[model samples]
Target chain A: MDIVIGVDIGGTKTKIGLVDQNGECLEQTFFRTQDFPNLTNYLDQIKITSDELIQKLGKEVNILGCGIGAPNASSKNGTIENASNLVWKESVPIIEKLKERMPMPMRIMNDASAAALGEMLFGGAKNMTDFIVITLGTGFGAGIVANGKLIDGYDGFAGELGHVDMTLGDGRLTGLGVRGGLEAYVSATGLKRTIMYMLSKYMVESRFRDVAYNDLHGEDITKAAEEGDEIALKAFDYTARVMGLALANFTAFTQPEAFILMGGLTNSGKWIMEPLERYFNANLLEVYKGKVKLMYSKMEGKTAAICGAAALIWEIQDKPS
Target chain B: MDIVIGVDIGGTKTKIGLVDQNGECLEQTFFRTQDFPNLTNYLDQIKITSDELIQKLGKEVNILGCGIGAPNASSKNGTIENASNLVWKESVPIIEKLKERMPMPMRIMNDASAAALGEMLFGGAKNMTDFIVITLGTGFGAGIVANGKLIDGYDGFAGELGHVDMTLGDGRLTGLGVRGGLEAYVSATGLKRTIMYMLSKYMVESRFRDVAYNDLHGEDITKAAEEGDEIALKAFDYTARVMGLALANFTAFTQPEAFILMGGLTNSGKWIMEPLERYFNANLLEVYKGKVKLMYSKMEGKTAAICGAAALIWEIQDKPS
Candidate 1:
């Protein structure tokens, strides 16, 4: 039996799992990422936890490699550069440090890209050679797959579709300080912004009217829209319009077979998907109409992150260098 | 010495050339495409012209394959589908017919995609694996190369950047009847539209003011801008702003090393290039800033088309199936 170590490094918690060739998480453990302010301590803890997980298995297993999903990670350089969410503000040579202890093949990519690989390896995009995996969480991120491989581009910074300008500087500014980006209109933060904007513009009766801006969650909006809240419905509609148009523009670039969406926003289900599909079809160029399908990620939540990270190893094994 | 048959099928004329592996045209011939109303006759002429060019070489040379660049061509199916510019409105099995007569390996791609392959094989993008070729002719077109391969997408209709919506339906209508597309604001037709719009909006004295809409040409706009005509310069400025911003959005999709510009609009020289570069840089996301270089295509005019078509064969030979 062969198993690979999968690591998902989040802003707060870090998950480490032993994933089998069948995309099954045999065992997993986690630690508070913020607990280790020092880089060396954090790496040491990861090693300790990984060793314990392997020891607990109590069965003979060939360790294949390790795959990590982190913020601002570069697969080309095997480093994380200036991740806003992580405690480390500088470039971290993660792959190098991990290899010293693990003594196995390893790969690292940003969480979104890892998820894309996961989708390709074990999710709905299993047979797709060309598609896009959109991560709609606190921010927008995408992993573009073409010719059955991820497009790392010249500097391994390809598929930053979230930052693609949407409003030409006229719309809301994103956390990155860029104005009118797709991230400013299509992410969780963007959804909240739209809700706030609509609340001010329209006098629709809604539970969100009393909720504070920072306190409001994406789930609250989804719940409200489900119960026929006008403001919440409008917000979803607005977000869908922006995303649909952007996806249409994206279609012109690659004409992928489908766009597989994941993350918090997708939980809104028909609220976002219905309008998004309608608008996407409406905006697509004539040649591409009714051709591209919109789909949801088969994997869910934390399980998705771990499986996606593990998928990195499986992906590399299949491709020739 | 190995040579390939290169064909550039244009709306008005068709150019056939015998090109050596070195990207040199040893012999060439032309015929008016409009003269052949039937697809069979048109394909037969191509075969006849190819044989004539090979015979004229006057020496024994290995004919490797044939590469074709035409409107709405599909390399996957070896056919041309519903090209608006061509008189034949139905799908034409061009490669199947041509191969029957010539009996050689053949490939067909849209002209813009062929140009991208050309750039990779023998032009500015020779050293760069990731780049884009933008054709700013009567209409806008792009050829996206990532990971050392053209992104033909699932249906072989990728890289239609011109049809990417720019205005969400509020802007000018493109000839394809789509409103607010990048084509409506950045092509040769778009430049003329800009001039016309500027002339109507402003009382600036210019050579274009006296010229009728149909009489006006893209070169005239370039010449006028060269002489520092206010309206002409402003028109170039307007066109560049739209194009620059659109390119910035495109940059986020695939962070290519450079964007190679070609066609009539590029003839505007610094009038378009200067402000265009400024806007492109200004609009780029922080991560992508100053990373993507803007360049002009090395090959020019009819020679470019022929060589680009020839490059397709060379490109395939370099890659293993």
Candidate 2:
């Protein structure tokens, strides 16, 4: 079967995998992405990983396509345009350079958009035409699939749902001048803020207090919530409320069939999902009360991101050149 | 040239017209819609108007289709559901009934959806693939056209931008039963409330005091503003600011090409548009600071609705049916 290589480049780690038609990944490799000083160095590491994977497979597999999923990748420009998390000076032509090195048809998309396509192809929202996929990582990120197609508007910046203002009046302030953006109260950073507020109010002492501010991770907080920690539970509750209200607002506007929640924090499952479902149902239109289901990503472990990036190639396989 | 019959059914009037492929209305007629107590009466009036129009202008014209625009119409079901202003008891099979009466293929869609399609086809957003059409009438309504298609979700209930809860805290007692909704703060009824609040704050008396509460009209307030009234301008400014912020929030999410403003209140022009534009620009993402445009609808008066309704049929024509 013809296979394509999928590369998911993140700030902390990078995943590479070989995927075929049905979104099945045969083999995958993981590496620390932060070891590289610049993008070219990062590309060199990716190339080495890809070559190693190809050599280990034995058979000379036909490389049909390649897809790169990066943090701030601009699909329209086919470059990673100054991802603050990644050490890039300006726009990095990863796709162009990769194409020259491997000599195969290739495309690149933002990580959230790629993850959304992966969800539509293989994860919770499989077979659904209209849905939303949100990556609840460092900051909340969203990609919209409307009327069965990805919403890549002029300049390919259509589905920035994370920036949709959540609070109206003199509420929370976002990094941007805008107040109450979805990311301001729903992302990993937002969750930390929620936890700090809860900690101050409840006067609770926890292991989290010993962790450095920058080192405080979402996984650690989720672990705390899973252990029935009240402060962590409050944090999850606040995140669920903000996220649920955001989802309800999005549903009222777009009326999607489902909302697929992804990223690290969702590992807490019932802690976040149960409360989110409750708030979402309460806030949704009466007719749409139970129609839209809130689902979690089915794909887990190292292969999900690479598998999603590979799914992007399969999606555009039949498109007119 | 192939032509289509466009019909706009409103609470007080029913407008029927012959529209050509170029979106030009060749012949038109209007009748009192409120006089009809049953669906049969309404259908019969349409029959009378259709026959008269055909008889006056040769009956052998190449009529391509018929399209109806109505309040609370469902593009998915092709029915006019129970609209608050209408006397209908339940959902009316508008498309099927009209097709039977006229013996022609027809389609039906919501007035807001039709207006959005009209703007895409013949109004200010002629070349835009992604834009929102906001109708500022009795209620705040929106029709979102994204990626060159109307976002009719699972139940054709998408693009309810008006119902998105605007109030943040204890929304149950607020205007839309959950904080501030676009309709709660932007519609004619909402604007009336704004005027009333302003009147109480400023303790001003004008022609507004002369008109009884129930009989008060949106135009009367606009006329007062037109004659250089401060209280009326303040009322308009509040609406403009809120609407501007709403648009900013919308653009951040969808990143549409433009915002095509329609409906009656839009007649106020700069009184609302200037401040709305200012607030919207101030709150937009940095990259999108000067990118998105805001424009008024080119199609106005009764024909606007008719042309907009006809656009649904034109849209279907371009689809792979």
Candidate by candidate, in order, the iRMS in Å equals 1.6, 2.0
Write model 2 residue lDDT over B1-321, tens digit each, in one string: 577788888765788888777788778889888788788878988989977886777756887788887876777888876565478856788778877778877888777888888878877788888888888776667888888888877777777777777555433122335566677678676677788777778866666656565776778778888997777788899888778878887875667888888776787777888888888888776646787888888876658878887786776777787
lDDT of 2 by residue, A1-321 (tens): 588899988766788999878888888898887788776777778888988888888786988888887765778878876564566656688888877678887888877788889888877777888888878765577778888887776666666666667656456665544577777678777888887777778877776667766777888888898787888888899889888888888886778898877776676678888998888888876546677978777777467778879988888786886
lDDT of 1 at A12: 56
TM-score of candidate 2 versus the correct structure, residues matched by position: 0.88
Cα lDDT, all candidates: 0.85, 0.77
Off by over 4 Å in 2: A31-37, A55-59, A82-104, A123-126, A175-177, A202-215, B1-3, B10-14, B29-65, B82-92, B96-103, B124-126, B169-178, B200-215, B314-321
Count clashing residue pairs per candidate: 0, 5
What local lDDT score does residue B238 receive in model 2, on the 0 to 100 scale? Answer: 88
In Å, residue B59's CA in model 1 sits off its true spot by 6.2
Clashing pairs in 2: B166-B180, B167-B179, B167-B180, B171-B178, B171-B179
Computed on C-alphas against the true complex, the DockQ of each candidate is 0.59, 0.52
TM-score of each model, in listed order: 0.89, 0.88
TM-score of chain B of 1: 0.90
Candidate 1 lDDT, B18-136, residue by residue in tens:
88877888898899999999888989999999888889988898988999988777778888876655789757888888888889889999888998998888888888989999988
Q: For candidate 1, write residues A1-321 as lDDT tens digits.
A: 899899988765788999988788888889999999899999999999999999998888888899998866788899987665578876899999988877899999887889888988888888998999898876788889988888887877778777777664566776556667788889887899999999999997889889999899989999999899999999999999999999998988888999999877898899999999988988887777888999988876657778889999977776797
